[model samples]
Target: PSRTEGNTRLYTDEDLQRLEFILNLARDLGVNISGIAIILQMRERMEEMQRQIHDFVQYIQEEVLSRATAATDASRGAIVPVRRPMVTPASQNTRKK
Candidate 1:
């Protein structure tokens, strides 16, 4: 927080958004300062993990495609994309029972 000549703290858009988020956690969710701190830390960690997972998946996909292309001969057809099987909600429910 930076102060102006009038001694008023100037808040940026990002700072305002963070303040609003903290207020919501305190007023709406009834989370105290310590709890809010913990929640924010966990959220940051989860976001970091998600980013790492996405990078790893991308790297693996690129490596596999490159290797496949190198291994294929002129007689063999070009690399074919493999489609993953989609699991619908109905299939999930059946498995549960």
Candidate 2:
């Protein structure tokens, strides 16, 4: 909480939410201030970990897509010709027998 020229306290949305959470923990769950502090720290850490994992997954996906596109573009003009072995009339007659 910050004070203005008139000494009035101002609370942001995040501040209000944190105040509400602390109040709930103390009033409803009987959590001490120390316990609440630890819980808040752990929650923040978990959120940070989630963000890191999401970022890593996004990076991998982008890399894979770019590489696949490059491979496709590089092979676009590549042509492979397949040749079948010539069959003679004598070979055909032997197969029929």
In lDDT terms, which candidate is top? Answer: 2
- For 1-97, candidate 2 gives per-residue lDDT tens digits of 9989999999999999999999999999999989999999998999999999999999999999999999999999799697999986677768888
Q: Where's the lowest-lDDT run of ten residues in candidate 2?
A: 87-96
- TM-scores, each model vs. reference: 0.60, 0.77
lDDT of 1 by residue, 1-97 (tens): 8999999999999889888999999999999999999998998899999999999999999999988887775538777789999976668768889
Candidate 2: list runs displaced more than 4 Å.
84-97
Error of 1 at 95 (Å): 61
- State the lDDT at 28 in candidate 1: 100
CA RMSD per model (angstroms)? 18.8, 3.0
**For model 1, what is the alpha-carbon lDDT of residue 93?**
69
Number of backbone collisions per candidate: 0, 0
TM-score (C-alpha) between model 1 and the true structure: 0.60
